[model samples]
Target: MTEIKQPIEMDITEVVKATGLASSAIRYYEKKGLIHSIGRKGLKRVYHRDVLMRLALISLAQQAHFSLDEIAQLSVNQKVPEINRNMVHSKIEEIDTKISELIQLRD
Candidate 1:
């Protein structure tokens, strides 16, 4: 008989190395419905590879100053949600305003 291998999974440690996000942050994201662990490997949470992409998107959105609430709205079911164009335009306008303010301060 041949031995069978289990499906690929990333434990919390692997995720931390891959994402550079603290374990707490990953758990928080899961708590906020931003991402989910596929299951667990013993005491460790296990997730599929796709979660790395979701984590990347979350980090980018945070850097862009999107609130957690906004991020939640922008992601659904572990994927980018259908966006409301007006909301996206509004965020852009907000960034533009910030840029203008920063330029004025620098002048």
Candidate 2:
């Protein structure tokens, strides 16, 4: 018989390793309601494996200059993160305008 191994729940250290984020950052996200942990493991927060993906999306949004509040609006805690198309479109337009301004200055 073959053994199946899986870590359905991960402690904060594991999440930090997988996401390259500091433990403090993870806790901050939880405090901000951007992500949640299932429970605690000996003082360490244990999160569902899905939280790795949520953190990834949060990182992506941050890189794109979205505020934490804006990312929260996406309902990051949900299994499938919800995107507000109108908000996304607005951001795209904002980016386009900034690019145009930068190009004008460069020229």
Q: Which one wins on lDDT?
A: 2
lDDT of 2 at 37: 90
Residue 22 in model 2: lDDT: 97
lDDT value, residue 16 of candidate 1: 97
Give the clashing pairs for model 1.
none
TM-score of each: 0.84, 0.93
lDDT score, candidate 1, position 41: 83
Clashes of 1: 0
TM-score of 2: 0.93
Error of 1 at 14 (Å): 0.8
* Whole-structure CA lDDT of model 2: 0.91
Displacement of the residue 34 alpha carbon in candidate 1, Å: 0.3
Where's the lowest-lDDT run of ten residues in candidate 2? 73-82
Residue 91 lDDT in candidate 1:
94
TM-score of 1: 0.84
The number of the candidate with the highest TM-score is 2
Per-residue lDDT of 58 in model 1: 82
